[model samples]
Target: MKLQTALRLIYPPRCVSCGDLVESDFGLCGPCWRETPFIEGLACDTCGVPLPGHSDQIEHCDDCMRIARPWSRGRAVLTYKDNGRKLVLALKHSDRLDIIRPAGVWLARAARPILQDQMLIAPIPLHWSRLLKRRFNQSALLAQELGRLTALSVCPDLLVRPKRTESLEGKGHDARFTTLDRAINAHPKRKHRMAGRHVLLIDDVMTSGATMAAAAEACLSAGAHDVSALSLARVAKDA
Candidate 1:
């Protein structure tokens, strides 16, 4: 066996999606990688939610109109289930910085249709307490990776998570919205940077949409011409 191969075997890389052993650092087994749902076809032009059972020409899911998302549009590379949850947890808790590169590259490629027109990238910032506890911000890592893939500048200081709130576990939509409504603030120093720019707000996942909503609100308040969101995954509403 080749020395490099033997050394790799000694350390045996594991897949991020399924935890299967692999020979390289791809973070997913070939099958799991292929199975990750890349949201496609005619989706809601506003929210990126797939229009199920509709023709390819269909656009705008009912939820988009009912809830009224603040961002102009958004897209996610995966549904937040199965392997996606594993990958997200690994990236957020296990310090898998390498995951950011491939995932961000994939997300950028998936979002090419819209992201190509965006002028600036800003990550949804974490509250200082959360950042201190985690020692890093997953959104920042994703923004860096997306910047590397898209050649767009990542402005990290544009948004600030001003206050920490209790965990959102078991929270309903109204409660989540209330908590997030008070958590984010626009950085005054960076307000001028948003003027007349189409901003791409990057986050690791879109759950109840409250966090992104707050961030997008801050961006709009700072004078961004328009704002859009791109996330690695979206939490599917339970059936």
Candidate 2:
């Protein structure tokens, strides 16, 4: 404990985005904090899209109406815009472990309703081929850290991306969905872990809800009682 305090005195906390010195632990500086596009209120119940109105009665957006999502509900901490996008990119490609704690804290607070006694947290998996190239899976990192925060059972191997699919970055909604349709599944041997359990899936971002829908469907087929999803950011795009 004494050594930890001395280390802290030597190295104070810095902003996650800009690396600017800050007073608090695992936080952003004032400017970056203001710049982050947090999705605070009135988001879609199904896909986490930000709703325009202040009314509480509205639940889902148009996309959710046209689409069939397997997950019962979804939650996101911020919009995939500006600083939020930058942070996600940094975490995904730059090995920015510095942001993991603060980001996981925000996701945990947002996912409170999804966390329950029977809940098991799992991440959307990447195929072994892709995993070898990337050297890490951002979703698994988020889920593991979230498990640490909530004391929930985190089974990162519960799901498997057995087949490698091309990057969905520039793909359209339907195209992405097509690519992910059967790409994800519950691990053959670990199916028992998902059976009769409520799963709270974690990911760094939700773009078309395609990935989450595919993952949730896999869990449900494996006998999961229910499935919901949480993410750090949600893509806001026109349907």
TM-score between candidate 1 and the true structure: 0.88
Best by TM-score: 2
lDDT of 1 by residue, 131-206 (tens): 9999998998888888888899789878998788888878998999998885887888898888889899988888
lDDT of each: 0.80, 0.89
Query: Which portions of model 1 miss their true places by more than 4 Å?
Result: 1-14, 19-24
7-107, model 2: which lDDT tens digit per residue?
Answer: 88899788898989998888989999999988878888877788887875758889999898888888899899899999999998898977888988999
Stretches of candidate 2 off by over 4 Å are: none
